[model samples]
Target: MSDIIRIQNLQKAYPGFALEGVTFSVPRGAVVGFIGENGAGKTTAIKCILGLVRPSGGGVEVFGKDAALLTAEERGRIGAVLGENCLPENLTAGQLDRVMRHIFPHWESETFASFLGRFSLPQGKKVADFSRGMHQKLALAVALSHGADVLVLDEPTAGLDPVARDEILELLYDFMQEERRSVLISSHIVTDLEKLCDYIAFIHNGKLLFFEEKDALYERYAVVHAPVEALQGLKDAVVAARRGEFGASALVRRDKLPAGTSAERAGIEEIMLYFIKGERI
Candidate 1:
């Protein structure tokens, strides 16, 4: 697959957490979810990619060209919606629209206006008067209006109601139908990603845990239940622990479970919970 964004041995240092040797490639036209717990370096990794924070080591390439060296013209192709609203609350939605339209050379005025109707954002109201969810939709509208090739979103679904979240995810799914557009979404909403992502990359404790295809995640990953005595000798399962009064259960790869063992298919939430609540990192 052609890579839209490639990170090679990426490293970033923090006072407490350090992103160490992280590497991943976001294939062109695919929606890849960057999953991790709070403070697990998801935003830090994204900031590095967006140049909001400089990496202490390694490289970032956008469209096969070094991101750090990209001119403003080259950088304009990438659009982002950060975790927080950076909009001027005093500005009316119309004013905000004008600002964004001016900033993005390819800005689609009709598309942006249509999204206002689609999102039901009031044009006359100041952003400060709008609820949290409204602002998020507005930010998304701005990102989509730019006619960007890549959408790099950070926690874009955090505040939306379930219906709105579904709508936004559906929009992403449709957006990629053009075969030249792509998205790199970092969200704690794993369930949403499970429904929308073509690829998944799990990051935790400032490190990468796993990177694989969505279908493989469901097919190869499994949750196994077994007795403590049985788990004691098990070497294939990374997750195994005694729980309650029943002994032990485990999260294992389907192919690696012991003889006679039958494990259930694991979903994204189950896989994430196994990583966080179980014995694994």
Candidate 2:
């Protein structure tokens, strides 16, 4: 499938932080989960993709056109939720609808109202009066109402309760039912991504670590609990390890383990923890 969004060696810099040549893509009809530590450049890379931040080097493309050069109509084709109360604070949902109609050529007021109803957001209340979760839902509702072909969501579910989060995920699932629709989302909630994403893109210390199929990532790594001696034999395959009084637990490549060695399945959270904080072999 073709990419709906592409980042080529994306780079950015600040006083203390730098996004160093991070590269990845969101393929058509796929949900790509962006995962990393808080300071690992995920947001910076996202901002670059949306053309909200100017990169010191590299490039981003959306819909086969340079992100930096996308016309207003082309920009309208992408739906973005930036994880903040970014909507007009003083405007009621109804008023915001009226305003957005003028901004987006394809904006659908009925779709927006349906989403508000589904989300239980009051059309008459000002956005500033909404709770955090309400704010998020409104942002998502607006994004989906614009007839966008792709979604760029940063921490979109941050303040939502389980039921609401599930509702949002369901909506996204419905969105992807159409061919060529895609989503790129980042969240601290790994379990959510595990359920919704086809691919996982990991970044660390300003570098792109790996961008791999989620199932293949799980198949490539396993958690082994064995004696220190057994772990020593698998050092080459161990990505990270921890030693305790009884034994050592390590994240290792499944295919590299010696015959008869048993390894348990590893979740995305466990794998991320191993990469970020686990002791290196």
lDDT (10s digit) by residue, model 2, range 1-281: 89999999988999998998888999999999999988888889889988899999999999988899999888898999987867889999999999999999899999999999988999999999998888988999999999899999999988688987898899899899997899999998889999999999999999998999999999999999988777878998898988778878999998887777788999998899888878876
Pairs clashing within candidate 1? none
Q: If scored against the real structure, what TM-score would every candidate get?
A: 0.94, 0.96
Error of 1 at 73 (Å): 2.8
Which structure among the candidates has the greatest lDDT? 2
lDDT of 1 by residue, 152-189 (tens): 99998997889878878877876788899889999988
TM-score of candidate 1 versus the correct structure, residues matched by position? 0.94
The reply for model 1, stretches above 4 Å from the true place, is 238-242
lDDT: worst 10-residue window of model 1: 235-244
